[model samples]
Structures are given as C-alpha cells and as structure tokens.
Target: MELKKKPTKKDNFVFLFKGSPLNDFLYPFKKAANQWVARYIIVTFAIIIRCAVGLGSYSGENQPPNFGDFEYNRHYMEIVTSLPLYQWYLQDLGNSNFMLKFPPLYAYHSFIWGIIGKLINKSWFELNNSIGCQDIDLKSFMRITVLFSELIAYIPSVIIYTRWMGRHYNKAPSIDQTIIAATILFLPDLAIIDHGHFQYNSFLLGIALIALNNLLYDNLALASIFFTLSICFNPMILYYSPIFFFYLLSLCFVPKFNLIRLIYIGVSVLLTFIVIFLPFIYSGGIQLLSHILYTTFPLNFNILHQSYPNFWSMTNHLLNNNIDLSNLKNLSIILTILAISPSCYAIFTNTSKRLLPWCLASCSLSFFLFSFLIDETSVLLPWMPVTLLLNEVDADVISMICWFFNTCLFSLMPLLKKDGLLLQYFVLGVLSNWLMGNLSWVRKFVNIIIPFISQRPNATPVLPHSYSWTATIISFYVTATIILSCDLLQIQPLVEIENFWEISNTFLSTISFGIFYVWLNFKIYTIHSLKAKSD
Candidate 1:
C-alpha cells in the first residue's frame, strides 16, 4: 500500500558528498553521537591553530635594550635558576626594566621551565649571557613552554567547567558543551596574547577558574587554596580578590554566623600563602616578605598610563602633563574602589552562586577601566568571566559578550601592531567571529547582494535583529579603517601631537570600554533584583 519515496534532488546531492572527507569529518557532529570524538577533534584543531599562530613573531622580536615581555619571561627564568630565593627579587633592582616584579610562585614556575630549557639546550638558560638572545631553538623551546602550560593548566580547567555546566545549569547536551569549550579555547585574545605575544596568563587564569568552580561546588577550603595560589602566581589576580572576599564573607553570615566555616577557610588561605612564601621566608626574613610585596605592587608615579585603553589614558591626553602625579594616583585609587564596591556589595547581599560570574565580570571590568597602572592585557580579566557566561542560552547575553570580546581585541591593536602581529591579529579575529556566528550576517548579506549565489544552510545570525548588529559592525569597520589607515599608511596627524595615532586608539577604546562597564553594572543590578524576587 505504501510506495517507497524516490530520492529527491537534495538527497541525491547529499549522497554525492556522503563519503567525502568533509562529510566524514563532520559525521560525528551531524549525528550528535560519540561526543568525545567530536570534542577531541575540535580540541586538536584548536591546538593546531594555536601552534600555527605561535610560529609568528612575538613581542619585541628583534628590538634590543627594551625587548618585550617574552624576553622578560626568559630573563626571569634565568634569575630564578641562578640566584638564591632571597636574591630573586633583588636582581637588577637598579635597572627597573630587568627587575623581577612578579610573585614568588611565578618565579618558581619559571625555575621549573628554566631547568627543562637547560636540559633541552644548555645555552638557552645561561645566566647573563641569555639576555636579548634570539636563538631559533631557544624561541621554539620557550613557545612550547607556553603551549605546554595551557595544556596542563588552562585547557583542563575549561573542560572541567564545561562538563560541570552540562551536568547542571541548562543541562546542555554533550555536543553543545564541547562547542562551548572550543569557543572559549578559540578566544582570539588569549591565544594571541599567550601564544603569539608570549605570557603565562592562561596558567594563572586556569587556576582562577578552578577556584571559581570549587566555590560553586561549596568547597570553601579548596576554593581558598586555589584562589590564593592564583594570586601568588600573578598579582593581576588581585582584580578578582574583592569579589571573592565578599562572597566568602557573605557565606559566613547569611545563613548564620558560622564560625567553623570561617576558621576553616581562613586557615586554608593562610596555609596556602605560607607554603608559597615559606622558602623565601626561610631564606630571608619578614623583611623579604615586605620586599616582595613592594615589588609586586610598585607605584609608578611617572607615567599616567602605559598606553592602556582606560580612564587614565583618556585623561592623560586631556591633562597634557598638567596633572600632579601623586594627586592623580590617589584619585585613581579612590575611583577604582568606588567603581568595584557596588559589585562587591551585590555579591555580599545576594550570596547566590549564579550571580558570581556577573559580579566577577563587573568587578574586574571596573578594575580594568578605573584602576591605576592598568595594562591592555588586563582586559583578559573581565573576558575570563564573560567567557564563563556563554553557558547561558540568553540571546542578549551572547550578543553583548560577542561585542565585548571584539572590543577587547580591538583595544590591543596598538600593542599588537607594535609587536608585528597585525596579520595574526586579523586572522584570529576573523576566525573568532566566524566561530561565534557573528559573521553570519555578513554571509547573508553577501548572498543577498549576489542573488544567484547559494546561501549556506547553517549560516544563521547569532542575533535575532540585524539593525543594531549592522550598525555595530559598520561603526567598528569605519573606526578600524581610520585607525589602520592613519598608522599603516603613515598619514600625519592634523594636530601636532606626539604618538597621535596611539593616543587616538587608546581614547576610542576607552569610550567603548566605558560604555560596556556601565551596561555591565546595570546588568548586574538587574540580575540581583531578579534573584531577590525569586528568593
């Protein structure tokens, strides 16, 4: 009674490509089966892309006397391996350029990597002689060290976080979780900064993510330990310190004043710090601890801002050397504290784990926009929390995150340009936008314009409305075109201002960051209000 349906044209077309490499590669994903296979494949692709990007030039590739952070990292390893624990922070104090300013755990990490480098190539870690050294083998070894650090630390944390999210919140399916993890891993800023520009930011961020995950699981002691370790690894982790402190404090009193939990967390944190600093304390004394603190939080009063796109950079142009250094420093401290206080207050009042990422995003963005001595790389702080938010299926949240992520990358254009990473920057930016589906609108527009061209079936816009999205895309295009033209085409400034192009880039980025900061604070407040209603 039923006749078999004849294969249609679409079915015939699909059959023609069924055994092709692309179809075979996408089979697991298409079927949504064997999620682990798909995840492994995606992760492998991400790693290959990262390694390929690492093959490009790094910060200060050939510049001497002021070779950038890459050289600083290599030099720090040399100091750690060659010097005593007490003398680690004392090296090159007269030359601020070469001084060891990071925390002890960083030095310890460098020491480990340095020993490995020594084993691989004896000359790579040679003290004093290694300064400004640019051997190809040495470069490869150093780049591998960063990649290895991410594998052991960063990537694992992301996998664990996504697994937890899949089990709990939204109960996202396995394939969806894998895609989310891959998106975070493909985040262009982290890859370009760590792999191309060279830093151990991912290692520190991974520890911080693990700490946040522990906090979510109500493992207070473990959370404290990992968070303390994160801070010990990099003082930049201090940006998230206020939120962590307030959240934990809220836990102590909200249900009831639980003295036992308080003591447990306090002891865990104190012990973690003690263990990290024990070697230095034993080698030197409490004075050494003071010295370490001083090195970690040095107040550079000379420069208003180091070309970082923030409140200070914008003001620096306006003030034009008229501002007093001491007064401006105090003002910056006050403003930063005020800016972060509301987020801290929200977390303390709400004490809900769901609000943690929003609070963290608000607090860290506050610090990046308002704090003194900010670095362009500090944008990564807020970005870490924002990336965690991708677990939500909210369209508004996803759209805002895509916009903010692109803004963060744009803020680093001057630095990337200075380091000869413009090509890598452009490539990674396009790749990230494509992965996020932010470029779907452009693809749709292309098909509309061409009329006869076939549109891709999967090309769906991430945002529902195209009007606002199109406006944003056009604004970014115009500004980026202008800035690149001015810098690359060597167009002279209309006004007689030194570093005009750099200043203009910084100011424009500051405006963008300022808008996002305001929106983020409002969003945090809205989240808290809704949470209160539910409670």
Candidate 2:
C-alpha cells in the first residue's frame, strides 16, 4: 500500500531546504505557526539570485560614447524629475538622445525614483553632467529599484496567481504551487535582462499578470484597471491588448451581454488612461499628448533591428546578407495582425482559462517573431505565459517549455555576453535544467561518450539536458553552443564577410525561434482540438 505523508511543522521546513543543512540551521521555524515556510524560503532564494546577478556587469556599463539602457533609465529619471511636467516629453536632455520616450506612467515611476536618488546623491541624476555616470552607489540604487520592484510587484503577483490557480484546480498541494511560483520568480531570462541588463519589464509584466489574475477572478473592473496600468507603464504590452480585449468581449457574449459590466470595464479603462495622461495633457494639451505618444511609439525606426531574431531580420539577411535591413514596415504590420488574429479568435470564441496563457503566448510570440522593431528582451513577454503554464507538470509540456526557454536565452545570448554575464548564464542554465529534472539521460549519454572522446571512464555531464525529448532539440542546442563558443572566442571571420559569425548567430537563432513559434501554435491547436473532442 502507498503511504501518505502526515503534515508536520518540520515538514514545511524540511521542504524549504529539501534536506539541505539550512533546514537544520533554521530548525526554530519548524515549530513556527506559519505554514508558508517553504514559500518564504523560495522567495528568499529568488531574491538572493537576483542580488547575485545584480553584482555582475549591467547593460551599458562603461560605453563612454553612448551608454545603453542603464544610462537611458537613469537619464529618464533626471529628465522627468528635474524638468517640469510640461517639458518631460519635450526635453532635449542627453543632447536629443535617450529622450523621455516612455509613457507618463513610467515617467511618474522615474520621477519617484529620481527624487529618492537625488536625496541619496544629487549628482546621480543631475542633468547632462550625470550622463554615463556609473557611480557605484547610483548603480546599486538602480539595481535595488529593479530588485525591489520585482519582489514587491512581479514575484508576489505570480505567487498569488499560481495559488489562485491551485485553488481553482481543487486544492492541489501548496507545495506544487510554491514550486511553480519559484520557477516563474527565478526565470533566468527575466532576472538576467531586467536586473542585470537593466530594464523595468518586470514592473510592467507584473501589472499585466495581475490584470490576468483579476480576469480569472471575474473581476472585470479590476482587470481593466490593471491592464490600463500595464499599457501606461509600457506601451509595448499592446501586443497583449488584443488577447485581453477578445477574452473580455467574449464574456459579454455569455450570460446575455450585461451592459452594466461592459460599461464599468470600458469606463475603468478609459478613466485610467485619462488620469495617467491628464498631467501631460493639461500641461501641453492634445498636441503634447500626441507628441508623447509618438515618442513612445516610434514607428519610423527601422522595421528590423539587427539584434532582433524576427522574421524580417532573417528575411533581411537573405536579401542583403548584411545587418543594415530594408523591409516594408507596412507589410510587417499586416503580417503580424494576420498571424495574431487566429489565436485571438480562438480565445474569443472558446475562452478557456487554461487556453488564456496559450493564446497570450501565441500572440506575444507572434509579435516577437514577425512584428517590426522587436527588442531582444521582448522574449520576456511571451515568457510570462510560458512560465505560468508550468503548473502543468506533464513531461512533454515541461520539455517543450524548457526548449522554448533555452531558445529565448539563446536569442538574448549576444546581449548577455555584452553585459559580461557568461558565468551567471552558465550557472542558471545548469541550475534550471537540474530543477526541471531534465538532466539524467544527457548525463548518462555523456558518460557513454566520454570514453571515446577523452579516454576517460565514468564521466559526468557538465550540464543537464532534455536531449532525450527530441533529436531536433539536441541538434539545435548543439549548433547554438558551437555558435556561442565561436562568438565568445571571437573566432576569425571568413575572408568574404567581416561579421560572418554574427550574421550566422542571428540567422540560426531566428530560424530556431521561428520553428519554436510554429510548434507553440501547433501545441495550442492540439489543445483546442482535444478540448473540442472532449466537449
């Protein structure tokens, strides 16, 4: 007969450390009343990981000529806090470069942080003189902001969402929910890019997740409010706007179109925009708001940046074999819309909560793969949905998620290398695979191959892999590793092309991501098909 483990105070503490010495070190917690010891431990571990990554090089660490996003964020702090509200968007700070292009919600956040920064060290956010100022204290302050915001906003929202999902699934074990929360909390790409590479994507992503959570609770009013907040914080989340719109509209179709709920949701969204933008609008009127909007959405920028691994980038490579891309931006938009519509439609008609994440992933991945001017970091958008789906512990789903996660990491590898995060990437890569239980077969295979390659017996795997899942994963990862090694080693270029390796890296990653995107859509379709048949 199978045995069921009885719950005890020590149980939570033991689970917290998974039998690590730390459990004995904190034995007092075993007797404590809180049943959430394991969860708190996971949260603490996640924070420690973020802090460790924060110790590494950040985006635009020392580039004197034009520092990257790190400086851009601090610059925004100075512009918004130092300048008048009317001049926030219109300022020529940083010599018309790194202008305050973000929406007012982000501007307000900067302003709040800027005030704190000025108190800590006035020079940190001082006008042009502070440009490229990589002050240690200031850098620490910036990292802390990202870390704290993630802890308070993103991590908590994910935990809450997962717990709610657990409850919805008929009281699944809290330990399972905690594990899912930790996985999402410690998503390597999100931590490395936002905390290490320097961005506020977590803040925006957190708000969006809360919005989704509210929708799950049937709190349409709160969902609209938070969704508006997300868009205001970062307009890039508009890629998800379609999914939320369709799902919320679908609600109207059911239970006979409740006009009051519809009006409440609409007005809530409308008022959020009005309140957030009122200061900008009042200071400079409609033209000012329009200017800010234009700044936020610079459609005129190149349709395909060299760093992005999207369809246009691959196509541009095929056309010109060079980084300077030329594409019909209008066509890219049309294609993105067409690609996203089916997923949105599926969600609108079916409206399964389980399918919501899949739909959002499809929409965001579609935008990331096909849309114009996608940033390398935009992978985090789709990652939110993928990570949320980790509650599904099926082996196939886990393997697929891991593959996509690795692909996302690989697509951002060049940027991560630029940030000097090679060590952190390796550690997190191995650790993530280990946690996911994706290591065994690859380790055995490595043992089998070591005798032939190194004339050594009983060799251990340097890293774990989901290699047994598919030959395609093995090939893709092997090629990616070779490409990454070449880039890291700065291998000699072919006589014909100066950036042959770089182009090859982008081309390979783009193709791989494109294949992953198609696979994801197929998975979503398969789920829909199963749901249909079951119904």
Best candidate (score: TM-score): 1
Candidate 2 RMSD computed on C-alpha atoms after optimal superposition onto the true structure: 5.4
Cα lDDT tens digits for candidate 1, 352-458: 77788888998998888777756758889998998988776565567667778888898888888888889999998988777666665665578778984744453
Error of 2 at 455 (Å): 26
Give me the runs in candidate 1 sitting further than 4 Å from their true place.
Answer: 1-27, 30-34, 301-305, 455-477, 492-497
Backbone clash count, each prediction separately: 0, 0
Question: What would you estimate as the lDDT of candidate 1?
Answer: 0.81
- Report every candidate's CA lDDT: 0.81, 0.77
TM-score of decoy 2: 0.88
Q: In candidate 2, residue 365 scores what lDDT? A: 85
C-alpha RMSD by candidate, in order: 5.5, 5.4
Question: Under the 3 Å rule for N, CA and C atoms, how many clashes does model 1 have?
Answer: 0
For model 2, which pairs clash? none
Shift in Å, residue 310, candidate 2: 0.8
In angstroms, give how far residue 202 of model 2 lies from its true place.
0.8
